[model samples]
Target chain A: MASEAENANQAPDEESIISDFFVPLARDWPGAYGLADDCATIAVAPGHELVIKTDPIRAGVHFFSDDSPADIAWKALAVNVSDLASKAARPVAYTLAISFPEQPSRSWLGDFTAGLSEAQEHFGCGLIGGDTDHATGPMSLAITVLGEVPIGKMVRRVTPSVGDRIFVSGTLGDAALGLRIRANMVDGKKPEQMTDHESLLVDRYLRPKPYLELRSALRAYATAAMDLSDGLGKDLGRMCRASGTGAAVYEPDIPLSDAFMAVAPESLEERRSLISSGDDYEVLCTVRADNVANFVALAASGGVVVTEIGIVRTEPGVTIIDKAGEAQDWAGRGYDHFS
Target chain B: MASEAENANQAPDEESIISDFFVPLARDWPGAYGLADDCATIAVAPGHELVIKTDPIRAGVHFFSDDSPADIAWKALAVNVSDLASKAARPVAYTLAISFPEQPSRSWLGDFTAGLSEAQEHFGCGLIGGDTDHATGPMSLAITVLGEVPIGKMVRRVTPSVGDRIFVSGTLGDAALGLRIRANMVDGKKPEQMTDHESLLVDRYLRPKPYLELRSALRAYATAAMDLSDGLGKDLGRMCRASGTGAAVYEPDIPLSDAFMAVAPESLEERRSLISSGDDYEVLCTVRADNVANFVALAASGGVVVTEIGIVRTEPGVTIIDKAGEAQDWAGRGYDHFS
Candidate 1:
C-alpha cells in the first residue's frame, strides 16, 4: 500500500490510484484479475464475435477544462458506447487510458472514478483494464469499448442500397446548439444567466445520451448504419460515398428539440448550421423501403423516436432540399479537426 | 474523396488522413471494412477467450518529441503487445487512437503509418479500427491490443505459489540505462559522441523487443506471470503482494546485457538503480519447483533465455540479497509517474 509520506510532494502514485479508485469498477469481471494482471481476458460466447470501437477525448478539444470530472468521465465512455450502438452490438467491457498534465487532486480523482462507476453501470459494461501516465500537455482520455454480436450480424456502414430510406435517431442539432450556447457563455457574449431551454442545450452538449435502445431495431432492420458524430450533412455524405449511392434529404423533416427551437431563430441559415455542426451522437442509418414501418415501430417500442429524414438515391452525393424546395448539395459540410 | 482544395487552409481533414494513410493498414482484416465502419468485429475460435491490453504513450513524457515517428509508432504497439505476451496469448488485432497537438505533416503521417504496417506484420496482427482527433496538448497514442488464449489457460499475475521459482526472460536494465544516456545527451551533460555499446543501450530504450517466444512455455508451466515494465524490483513486489507471497532475488543472478555492463559501473548502487527504473518490457513469471527444468528447456527451445532470479517466499515483501549476503527490502523502489 502507498502511504502519504511516499507521495508527500505529489499526488498519489499510479499504483495507489488504481488500487484505491479503479479497482472497484473491475470487481464484477472475474477476468479483470482485480486490475492486478497485465491483461484482461473475456470469454466470447459460441457463435458470437467481439465488436470493438475506440474514440478519445482531449481537454479543451472535446470538453471544457472547467467541466465536472464526472461529466468528463461520462462523456468519454458515452461517445465510444455510441459507436458500438451504431454497430448494433451490446457493450460488455472497456479500457480507459488517461494522461494527466499534472497530478490530479484526490477529490478530483474520487469524482472521476465515481463518474466512471456510474457510467459502467448505466452502459451495462465493466472496466477490464487501463493505463494512467503523466503528461506534459493537457489531460486526455482514450476509451476503447468491446461489445459482442452474433457472427456476421454487426450492422455495416457501406451496405446501404440506393433506394433505402435514411433515418436518424433522436432529435438533431441540440448538442451542436448547446455547444454554441456554451461557447457564447465562455466568451462572455451572452448573459451569465440562461433560460431552462438554454440549459437543456448546454446539457446536451456536455452529456450526450447515446441511443443504445435502438441497437435491436438497427440489427434487425437497418441495412447500413453509423453514429452521427460529424453532423448529418457530412456523415451522411460519407455513408453515401462509401455505399456508392447518394441521398436527398428534406430540410423541413429535420428533427429539432423543443429547447433548440425555443432558443434559436427559424432562419434557413440556422437550420443549415445545425445540420452541419458535429457532436450529435445519434444513429444515422438506412432501412429498406419495405422495412421502414417495422423499423420505426420497433424503435418506438423501445422508447426511441427515429425520423425518416431522406431517401438514398442513385446519384453519388448528398442533396439537402430547402424549405423553398430548392435542392442544394451539402456534402463535406461538417466539423473537420484539421480545418 | 477529399480533394486538395478542401484542405487548402490547413492540414488534410480527418477523412483524408484515414483514407490515405490508415486504410492500407486495415486491408488484411476483413472485419475492419477498410476502415470505413465505425466499429470492427473479431471472431474468436471456439474454446478460446480474448485477452486485451491498452497502454498509451505521450510525446515529451514517454518519448522525445524529436524522435522519429516510425519509432514512436512501433513503441506504442510493442508495449501493448508485451502485455499480451505476458498472458501467454497470441495477438490478433489492435486499435490505435491518436491525438495530435497540431495536424501532422503528410510526410510525418506517412512514416507513422508505414511504421505501424511494419509492426503489425512483424507481430502477426492486423489493424482493426481507430480514432484520430486534434488536441490542444502534446501528441499521444493509445493502443489496445486483442489476443487469444484457450479458455481457462491465461497465465495470471496473482497465482504464484509461495514455493515457486521466479524467472525473467531476457536481460534487464539496458533500456533504463539507455534512457539515462538519452537524458544526459538532451541536457548537454554528456559528450555528443557515443560508443557502440552506448548506441546499443539507446536502441533498447527506443525500441524494445518483447520476449514473445516464451508464451507457450509460460502457458504450459508458469503458475503466474506478468510483463516487467516497471523494473524487476517493483514489478516483483506487485506480483508478490497480489499473490499473498514474497520474493528473495539474488543480485548476482540478475541478467545484464554487455552494453549495459560496459557503460554502467559495476557498483551496487548502479545495480539497484537499474533494477528500479521502468520500461523493460520483459516477461516475468514463477514456475513450480518441479516444472523449472521443463520450463527452462521449453523456453530455450524457442530461443529465449530464462534466468532464475529468485524464489517466491511466504513473507509479504521483496528482498534483494547483496554480495555480502545481506537482504534489503526493495518493495516500493520503482518509477512513479506522480512522484
Candidate 2:
C-alpha cells in the first residue's frame, strides 16, 4: 500500500490535501512553520529540540491491494524511517496508530509482526507505543518516527545552498518499472532476465532502504537532504522550494539500473512519469561540490552508491538539461497529496 | 458507529471492517512495540522521558453517533489527556491523526477544529504534528498526546506502596449520567438543574478536566496514582493488581452531587453501574496516610477537590464496603479495550 500511496500522494492533488489536512494541522499545531511547511518545529530535549514528521498510507491507495503482509509491514516501518532519514536524524523511537478490522486472523497479524520485527532490527528503532482498534473501513497505517540530530546539525528541506551539488543514493526507476512488470505492461520479457533484477526492483519498491547511515554523513557533508519518497523530478522541485533556489539536472545523469532500462527502453513517456512517480525511498541530497567525492566515498564504504545528478542554482525555478545541455521542460516532476 | 463499536468490539467478529472496504496504509514504520501495548514509552528529553498515548474516538463507539462535531473533538483530546493525567504527567504536546470522508463541509471541520483549539488553550498543550487522510467509512479521530514527566515523577499503575491512602480528585459517576442522558434513559432533567449541583458532574462527564495540578503534586506527595478512567470499581481493581496490594472503598462516602441524587433517586442500579462504567477522567491516587493531610491542603490550594475513598491493603484484590463496612457487589466495571 505504501508504494502505491507513495505514488498516489504525489499526484497533483496536494492542494486539496493541504487545504483539508495541513490547514487544520497548521491551525492545531501552531508553531514556527505550522502545516504550511514540511515538518513542524517543536521544542524538545531542552537545549537540543527536535523536528517531527508524519504521513499516512492506505491499502489499495498506497500498495497493491494484494501485497504480501510481510512486504506491507516492511514498507510501513521503512517509510517512516525514510522520513527520519531525510532529516539527517538518528531515529530514537516511533509510535504507530493502526486501524484494523474485526477478527484479523492470527496468521495475518503474525506476518505483519514478523515484517515489523525485521525492519525494527534493521533500522534500530524502538517502537515505544501506538493505538490498535477495530475499523470497518480500509486498512490504514500511520507511524510517527522521532529522531534526534544536533540542533544545528538537523538538515531540513529548506537548507540547500545555491550552487550545491545534488546527489542520490541507489538506482532511480527500477521500482517504478517493477510496478509496470506487475501490471503486465512489459511484454516479451524473459523470466530469467527479470528473475533477479525485477524481483530486486519489486522488493526495493516494497521496502526501499531508509538510508540511515547516510543521514549523519549527509548532514556533515551535504548542505540539504531529503528522502526520495516521490520520484526525483517532483521531489527535487520540492527541495528547490525549500531552499528558495532553483535546480538544473541532466536527464542522462539520473541514476538508472540495468533492470530499469531493459524493462522500459521504448517508454520514454513512461520513463518520464517514473521520474515523478515517487516511492523511491532513497536519499536525495545537495552537498558542496568540493565534498561530493568524499560523500560518494562514505556511501561506497558502506556498499551503498551515491551519484551526483544535479546542482542547486540561485535561480528561482527548476530546470532539466539534456545530454546536449539543452534545458528540457520538466512540467511533471513529483506527486501531490490533493488534486 | 463508535457507540456500537464500543459495545461490540470484544465480540470477535469486528474485522468485517476491512473486508467490507478496500483501503491501505503505507508499509514502513519502524517498531518492536508497534501494536501490542496500551501506551508507548518514548525517550523525549534526556532526564525527562515521555509516555505517548493515542486513542481513536469513532462515532457510535466512544460517543453517541449523533454527537455534535464540537463535543466529539473535545472528547477526543480530553480522553488522551486523561491518560497522561492518570500517570500524573504535565501535558506538553499532542499530535492528532484524523481521517474522514472527502467533501466534508468546511463548517463541520470548523466546529471540530474550534473545539480542539479550545482544549489546547485550556490545557497549555500544543498540537505538535500528525496526519490526515480520506476515509469513506465512519468518522474516526485518533489523537496522540506526548507528555513529559521527570523520570522519577512519572508514576505507573504498577507502583503503589502498602498502607497508602487511596484518594480521588473531583467526583465520579457523572460522566456515566451524561451517557445515560445522551441515550435518552435519564429524562425530565432541566438545563438549570445540571448547572450547580450536577454542573461539575455533567461537565466532568462531557468535558473532563484533567488533574494536571495533581500530577506534579503527586511526585513529591504520592506513592502511586492513576486517573480513574474506567470507573472506581474497575480502576481500583487495576491499581490493586498492578501494585500487588488490596483496597477497600466505603460506598456511602462515594462523591456525588445533590441534583444527581434528586434526578435519579431510583437509579441505584445506575449508580452502581457508574462505579464500574469507566471514562470518568478523574484521578485515583495512593499516598502514605501520613502525607495525606499535606497533599489535601496542596490540592485545595490548586482549586482541586480530592476525596479519600479507600485504603491500600497489604493483601491483593479489591473490596467495596457500604456505610457499615459490609461488602458490596457490582454487575461489571469500566471499559476494557480488548475485554
Candidate 3:
C-alpha cells in the first residue's frame, strides 16, 4: 500500500499530521510523549476508580458528512464524556482513534484541533494517546474516555426502587428536532425559514454539552442513573428493566423548550414521538422522595434545571399518561442503530 | 434512519445482538454489567500506572476482507497487546470499537467471540467496555488496550546510549514473506506450491504472538525498546531519531526462519528488501553491552530467543552492513499508513 501510494507521491504522511497538529494538543499531558511513543502512562489518584467508555461515531451515521470539522471533533469527545458523567465520574483523559476518508486539509485539521483544545480545557482532561489511519470509506472517530470517581461511589444504571421519583436535567428532544431540521425533513417550514430559537435546536444537535456539573447531585441523591442519549422513553425503559421496576410518566410533564413547542409537532401523539426521539445528553435519574428537594436544590445551585416527570412503580412496563390521566399507546420506541 | 429501517422491516435490532451475544463474553467482569451499562469502572493497584494504546485495523488494509473471522479477531487483540508488551506493561483490559460492513452471521460472531475469549484468557485481561456499529464502508476494528506497570517504570521509546547493544526477539521477515504469499505476489513459486514450513510463516502473519514474557528482562536490562512492526530498518530509524543516536546493524546476524529462506527471495539485495518489509511484531531494544549475556540468559529462561543484531553508535542514522562488513543502501523505508 505504501509503495503504491509512494509511486503516486502523496505529500504529507500520517506521522507529520500527528507531529504538527496532534502533538501540540497533547503537550500539556506529561504522559503523551509528544505523540512519539506507542503508548501513554497515567496514574489514578489513590482513592479513585477509573471509569471507562468507548463510543464510535461514523461520518454519515452520527453526523452529516459535511458537518464542520470543528463541530465533528467536539461531538466526538463530548459524547464519550457524557458516558462518564452518567456514572458520576470526573473526566481525566481520552484516547482517540480517527480514520480519515482521504488526506484531510490543513484548514480542516487546524479547526478540528482547535475544537479539541477547547473541549479538553473545558472538561479538564487531556489527549493521552491514539492512532490515526487512512480509510477508503467514511471517517470514523472512536474515542475511549477514562474518568475517575471516588472508590465505591460511582452511580449505576440499576437499583431504582418502587416510588422513586424520576427526574431529568435539562430539556429533552431538542437534538432530535434539530436532526429533523438538518435533514430538511421538518414538517412545515424549511431550515432557511427557521427562527433564532429554532437554530438553537440545530446547535444542540451539532454540539451536545454533557451534563458534567450534575455529577455531584446525582451521586449524592440518585439510586439509578444514566444519560439520555437514546431518548427519555427508551432509556428509561432500559433503566426500569435493569432495576426490576417500571415507570408512570406524565406526557404533559416531559420537559420541552419553548422553541420545541413553538415549531415541533404539537398534538399529544406527535409531541410524544418528538420527545422520545434521542440525543438529549442529559442526566436521567431516580431519586428517593425524601431526597427530591435536596437533589433539586443541588442541581439548581449547579446552574442546571431538574424536572420531575414520573415515579417508579412495581408494574412490568412503561406507562405514559396523557393530560386526562388516560394511558396512550407509544408510537415509537426510540432510536435503534440497527432495526 | 431507524424509522425508515423499521418501516423496511430489518431482521434484528442492535440491542438484541448486544444482549444475546456480547453480554455472554462480558459475564465474568462485574464492571461490565453484563454489557448493560454505558460505562465500566476499575480500580488500579495503588502503586501502578495505566498504560494505554489505540490502534485501528481496517479489513482491506490490515487483513483480507475474506480472512477467517477468528483469525481477524486474534490479530486485532494481539496487535494491540504487542504495543503494551513493547512498553513493558502487563495487559489488564481493552475496549473494542467494531464497525461491521454488514450484519455478521451468528456463526461468524460465535467464532469471533471464541477467538476473543481465547486471547483475553491467554493475556490475562478482561473486556471492559466498547461500541459496535453498522457501517456502509469496510469493516474497522479499533481497539484501545489498557495495561499496568509499576509506577515510574513504564519503558519508553527513547534514552538509548552510545555503546548499547541492540537486540531483537524471534526471527524476522517471515510475516512480510507471508504477506506476499497471501497476496499471490511471490516472485517464483505460487502460494499453492508452499510447503508446511512456508505455511507456518503465513500463520505467523495471520496471528502474532505478543512477547509479554520478556517484559521483566526488558525492564531490567534494556535502555530503550520498541516493537519492530513497520519493518526493522524504518522502526530502527525512528528509535535512533528519538534517542539521538545511530545504529550499525549486521545483515547476516539478523535472524530468519528456515521457512522464509526456503521460499523467500535470494541474493543479498532481495533478502534485505524482504527483511525490511514490515509486520514483524518482535521486540527491538538497545541494551548495555555488559548486560547482553544476562539479558540473553533471562530471555532463554523464558523460552524466547534474543538475537544481537546491532549496536547503538554516536552517529545519527542507521547503517545496514552486509556479510562483507560493507554498508548497503536500503531501497525501501517502512510502511507508512499514509504516504
Candidate 4:
C-alpha cells in the first residue's frame, strides 16, 4: 500500500492518508493487501470458528468531544474487542470505519493511529482495511473485531441455569464515578483537586481493561457469559431475561475498586445509581456451584480477580438485595441509547 | 431476537428497537446468536479464505440528507459488498454499525431494514449481527462485509502487465450525471421534465449494480481488477499506480450508455469532466492481450458487456487521448475525502 509520494510532505487526500498512515498499521497482516486492494483476506485457523462483533462510539455521547485523541482511539477499538473477550475468543484482526468532522491535523492523526497501533499490539490483533470519510457532523468511529475460538466452544449468554453462581471480573463503579468527575457533577471537589485514588477513577472511565487473559477459564467453566458494558445491573438483567431466568445479587458483594470507593456515594439510592451506571467493560458470567472455586483459581492465574456475587434463579427478573435484607429500587437500567 | 414487548405500542428503547426490527433480519443466521449474545460465531466454509471489507456512508456526503431510507440502506450495504464483488469473492455474512441523530419513526426503521433485507437476499449474504447507537450528529452507517474465495485465489489490484488490454464493465458517467440531475445542476431541464432515459441515469446514480456476475471471468481472465467507484479515469489511475504501470485510454472507445449520450456535454472538456466524476461502481480491469476474446465471450455469457477502452503501457501515468490524436489535459482526479 506504500507509494513514493507517501513519504513526501503533502496535503492529505483519501489515498495518501491511507497509504501514509493506515498502511503501516496494516503491515503485519499480509492478507490486508497493505490496505490497498478492494478487500482483505484471511484464512481462519483450522479447528476454530470466527467470532465477530461491531461497536461504535461518538463524540459528546460516548466520550467528550475534546477528549484526547489517543484515548478516543483506544476506547473505540477496546470496546469491540472486549465483546470478543466476553465470548472467550482471542483477537485476530479488526476493521475500523471512522468519520471526521473535518480534516484533522497530521499530529491528531499521528496520535490517533499511534494509539490504535498500541492497542492492536497489546491485544495481539492486526489492523485490516477500513473506510475513512469526511463528516459534517461530530466525529464517530465504528470498529468490527474478528476473533477466533475453539470450534463449538464459544460461551453463550443465555444458558445460565437456576442455582448457578453468578460472578463478575475485576470491579465496577469506577467508570461511572469517573464520568461524574469529568462532567464536574460530583457532589464535592473538582477532578484536578481530587486525591490520587479519585484520579484513578477518572482513568478507569477513560481506559477499561478488557478481561481477555481470563477468557480460557471463562469458556471452560462459565455456564453463560456476557460483557458488562451497560453496567452490571442492566447487563446481568439482560442475561437473565435471555435465559428465561433471574438473578439475586447481594448489593454489598458487588465489587468496587478502591478508587471508586473513595469518591463513591454513600446513600443507598446514590450507590444504586452508581452500581447501575454504564461502561464497566468487564465480564459477567455464571458458573456451576461446584466449578466456582476452580474458575476463580484459573482466573487468578491470569491476574484477573473474579468475585462471586449471587445466584441465578428460576424467577424472571433481576432482584438486588440490600444489606438490610430488603429489595432496593433503581430509576433506570444503565445507559440505553434510545432511551 | 424477537420479544413479546416489541409489538406493544410504546416509545422505542435500545432493546425494543432491536427486538422489533433487527431481530427478524437476523433470524436466518443461527450463528448470529439471535442478536442476543455479545458476539457471533461462524465457522468459515472449509478451504475458503475470508475476504473482508468495511465501508461507511454518511448523510449529506454520500447521499442527500433527505434521501429515501431504503435507498440509503441499500447504498450502505451495496458499497461494502461491491468491494467483495471487485475481489471476485462470494459474500457470506455482514455486520452493521449504525448511529442515529434521533430515534427514527417505526416506519423509517421498517423501510430501512426492509431494504437491508432485500439487499441481503439479493446478494445471498446473511446479516450476522450489528451495533446500534444514538448520535447527536447525522445518521450514518458502517457495514463490514465478509465474503469467501477459494484459498489463495482472491483477485488482486496490482498485477496488470504492460501491454495488457484494459477493459471496463458497463457504462460510465450515468451515476455522476444522476447526481447533477438530483442537485438541479443539470443544464436546460428539470428532473420531472426529463425523458425516461434521463430518469434511468438518475436511478443509476442512486442504485449502483456491482458487477458481481462478471466475477468468475474476472478472476480467471483478468490480469488485475478494481471496482470503479471514484470514476474510471481516477480509479484507473490508481490501478496503474498500484501495478507500477501506465495506461492509454482511447476517448472514443470509452463506454457510454444511450442515456448518457442523450444528455452528455459535447465539448471534450465537459465529457472528460463527466468521465472523471465519481460513483460509477462498475469494474475496471486489464486482461492479457491474448485473453481478450475469451474474456469477452465469458463475460457475455454472464450477460455483462465489457468494452476494451484502453491498453496498459510501460510509462507510469494515465494518458487520456482525444479523438484528434492528442493528449487532453484534465483538472483534478475523482473524489478524495480530504480534498
Interface DockQ per candidate: 0.80, 0.11, 0.72, 0.79
Give one digit per residue, the lDDT tens place, for model 1 in B8-95.
4446668888999899999999989999999999999889999999999888777877777888998999999999888899999999
User: Which scores higher on DockQ, 2 or 3?
Assistant: 3
Q: Candidate 1, residues A1-339: lDDT per residue as tens digits? A: 667555444467788889988999999998888999889999998899999999998887788877789989999999999999898999999999999888886678888989989988999999999999888777898999999999999999988998899999988889888888888787664534888899888888888888889988999999999999888988998888988899999988988898988887688677678867889999999999999999999999999999999999998889888789998766458888777
TM-score of chain B of 4: 0.93
Where in model 1 is the C-alpha error above 4 Å? A1-10, A187-193, A329-331, B1-11, B186-193, B329-331
- Cα error, residue B299 of model 2, in Å, equals 1.3
The DockQ ranking, best first, is 1, 4, 3, 2
On TM-score, the stronger of 1 and 3 is 1
Give the distance in Å from residue A189's predicted Cα in candidate 2 to where it truly belongs: 14
Task: Evaluate model 1: give its lDDT.
Answer: 0.88
Candidate maximizing lDDT: 1
The numbered model that scores best in DockQ is 1
Clashing pairs in 1: none
Which candidate model has the greater DockQ, 1 or 2? 1
Candidate 3 colliding pairs: none
| Cα lDDT tens digits for candidate 3, B188-291 | 55556778877788888888998999998898998888888889989988888887888899888999988988978777667778788788899999899999
- CAPRI classification of candidate 1: medium
User: If scored against the real structure, what TM-score would every candidate get?
Assistant: 0.95, 0.79, 0.94, 0.94
Q: Give a tens-digit lDDT track for model 4, residues B1-339.
A: 656356333457778678888888888889998898888888888999899999888887788766678888888888888888878899889998888888776777887889888888888888888988888667898999999899988888888999999998999889888878777733456666878987898778777778788878988998888888887778888888888898998988989999898887787667778888878888888899999999999999999999999999998788888889887655236887777
List chain B TM-scores, each candidate: 0.94, 0.80, 0.92, 0.93
What is the Cα-based lDDT of residue B152 in candidate 1? 91
